[model samples]
Target: ITGELINIINSPDTSEDEHLLSVNFIQADTKGPEFKTTYNSTAQAIRIEFSTLELVLHQGVVLR
Candidate 1:
């Protein structure tokens, strides 16, 4: 699966800090458990949620 990064949002709150990343899958190919090559336009993209603390702990963080 290969996708293009669309957007990233960082929001920190007093209780929970999180990050959200949106990715659009331009190409996908699988042949192991299943065989698929294309996806519907609505299902071709997804949002990935993460914790801001996790990023900070990782040391270096770059978004480009």
Candidate 2:
């Protein structure tokens, strides 16, 4: 997936500014991997790599 743009829309919590939590962990009354949140129009970068060749990864996020 070279040169592929991967949008990473992190709809953080309005209160704690935390990333979206797993639906199963929340009281969403559902049983699946779901994330419901809204993001601003500030377009962010789309980075995804499985190796250090494209970019370095410390914890699933690009380390630049």
Every model's Cα RMSD, please? 15.8, 17.5
Per-model TM-score versus the true fold: 0.19, 0.17
**Tens digits of lDDT, candidate 1, 1-64:** 1364433443555343323444434433343232343443232355555544322322223532
Best of the candidates, lDDT: 1
**In model 1, how large is the Cα lDDT of residue 60?**
28
Q: Quick one: RMSD of model 2?
A: 17.5
Where model 2 places Cα greater than 4 Å from the true spot, the runs are: 10-61
* Residue-level lDDT tens digits of model 2 in 42-62: 233243332212333344445
Top of the candidates by TM-score: 1
- Return the lDDT, model 2, position 31: 33
The lDDT per prediction is: 0.39, 0.35
Q: Can you list the residue pairs that collide in candidate 2?
A: none
Number of backbone clashes in candidate 1: 0
